[model samples]
Target: MADVMDIVIVASAFGMDAVRAQGHLKCAQASRRAGAAGFEVRRELFAGEAEAAPQRLRALGCAIAELGLWSVFSTPAALYTADGRLDAAALRLAFDEASALGARFVKLQLGGFVRDAAGAEIAEQTQDSNVRLVVENGQLAEGGSLTQFVGLFDALAREEHAHVLGMTFDIGNWAWRDVAPLEAAAQLAPHVEYIHCKTTMGEGARRFSAAPAADDTRFIAVLDRLPRDVPRGIEFPLDATRVEADAAHYVEWLAAV
Candidate 1:
């Protein structure tokens, strides 16, 4: 068997609708009970704006820390704006929110990133922060395409800014962009420090996030290519009725895989 990876249960996997109904506090308890090594808090999942306030986040952080699970903060906001400029205010808020939560990493989408001199600014913004930022390939071509990632990383490298940025490689996201996961892993694995474990299930092109089956060779193949030391997050949907069992099962299975 290969080395086991740490499993991080993304709160949204419990279902966005369900989370909105109960809030993430309950989910955090379940995650720790399932023996997850970490938990990912979705910014978009917060029930209200006040729930994400700094003081509330600090309290949540304390609660999570007491459970003995490390955390990662995820924001739906993209790292760049539509015009290819760095969303500095968005970036700063993300860091503040993640920092308040005492998270190890803040995950963001690589949005509208056109290669330019602005890539270097990432280092300056992150230098004083305790939390690190890792950009993920989203479902669209603008920031989610393989070519886009390669270009962004390349530009940052030229400016010596690559060291400050890392990737959250989502295996299932490639399908949305019509890109092959294995091919992406082959090129982007070097920069990947985290993984989102997902496989699509559908009757046609309109697929949805589903847990990878035990015998799923495609998931294993892509996972094998990424860094073994990196953490794996269960981003796929968990059975709503059996969230406990499903969460526990994947937490163990994903780690062993």
Candidate 2:
């Protein structure tokens, strides 16, 4: 049998719909008990828990797989202030925080990159960082299309920063932009360092749900297209009433895949 991949439980899943309270320490403890190999610390879920997040996760024996930040790096209007300059200070702080948290990867959105000053700054700063920088195929506005992501990654590769920069392939995010998951996976798999595994239910404005069983052909097909060595994280809604059981089931299901 092949070795099981590392399964990480993203904190945001548990806190969905405000069902579970937001507490990084509590989330870490639950994740460790639920058989998750690691925990992803989301910036939105951190709230005021940022300062001591690393220490808290350490005490709970939960490995920090990635630090997820929500920042738009495309246009100066989104990343800069009134003075029309790149917010290098803010960007540095985000990277610094990820480093302090002991996370191996810092995940962000690929804002805008062709001749964009912010993108240039990101490549320059990431070259010197200890943590790997991963840009994800977020919802439409961030980076939802295969063409968009490929262009960005190809651009970075030419700059020689691809070694330090990687891709976080979100399996279900393709649906949000009408892109086929398999096609996106095929194009981005080589550059992937992390995977966000989630499936959606319903047609319009679908609800994010856990991965199907390993035997499910759709699930297996997508898994086969991704890099097995990369850490795959569960980024879905959790049943607050049965959070532990739900998490454990997800881990087992993904392991089988």
- Mind giving the per-residue lDDT tens digits that candidate 1 earns over 1-257? 86867889999899998888988878889998898989999999988999889999999898998999899999999998989999999999999999999999999999999877275577789999989899999988778999989888888888877778899999998889889999999999999999999988773466788889999998899998899999999999889889899999999898888
For model 2, what is the error of residue 235's alpha carbon versus the real structure, in angstroms, after optimal superposition? Answer: 0.7
Cα TM-score per model: 0.97, 0.79
Kindly report which residue stretches of model 1 are placed more than 4 angstroms away from their true locations once superposed.
Answer: 203-205
Which residue pairs show collisions in model 2? 74-112
Task: Report the poorest 10 consecutive residues by lDDT, candidate 2.
Answer: 69-78
List per-prediction Cα lDDT, in the order shown: 0.90, 0.65
Q: Which lDDT value does model 1 have at 192?
A: 96
Residue-level lDDT for 103 in candidate 1: 96
Candidate 2: lDDT of 248? 88
Candidate 2 TM-score versus the reference:
0.79
